[model samples]
Target: MKRTMLAVAGALLLGACATPSTEVGIALFNDTVQPLMVTGNTGTKVGRACAKNYLGLVITGDMSVEAAKKDGKITQVASVNKEVKGYALYAEVCTVVTGR
Candidate 1:
């Protein structure tokens, strides 16, 4: 019973702690999302690129501004956005770009 109680307490603490992507393995969940305006000029094309994380071991995909621009077939970037979400042993990050 003591072990069980201690485990529960530890889990609670871990889950309650703020987790950054660099230390995601220690937390139960994490999330970070935001929008960014790169330039005042607006564009009509939109593109997105994403990367996935598994057990914090393997990460695959291209979550870069250049990748997003390429995916959208854009030459000029006007805005950018980023999103991150993680749960348990899995996480994903994505980048969104808008350009002309």
Candidate 2:
């Protein structure tokens, strides 16, 4: 009976140890875009790259620029195709740092 109790406790502990994918997903998104050039990259490029990398790390859901915009997840608006898109997004993200 003691062994059974111990096993149950261990199982519960192990189960609780399972990593939470939600936080990881958000972190993954933050990490992917955090290091990029927030000034040089266009908004579209930033949006696409950020979404691709962030969503790519996860096992589910679409990560396109349109999807991001649709979901209102992109705090900055990027161009649809021009390099300016990425640059715009970068500018938005780096406003505090660049003051441009």
Give candidate 1 misplaced runs (Cα > 4 Å): 1-27
Kindly provide the TM-score of model 1 when superposed on the true structure, using C-alpha atoms: 0.68
* CA RMSD of all predictions: 4.7, 12.7
How close is every model to the real structure, measured as TM-score?
0.68, 0.23
lDDT scores in order: 0.76, 0.31
Q: Which candidate wins on TM-score?
A: 1
lDDT of 2 by residue, 7-32 (tens): 88765544332322232342211212
Task: List residue ranges in candidate 2 displaced over 4 A.
Answer: 19-100
Give the total clashing residue pairs for model 2.
13
Q: Per-residue CA lDDT of candidate 1, range 61-91, in tens?
A: 8999899999999998889988777676567
Worst 10 residues of 2 by lDDT: 91-100
TM-score of 2: 0.23
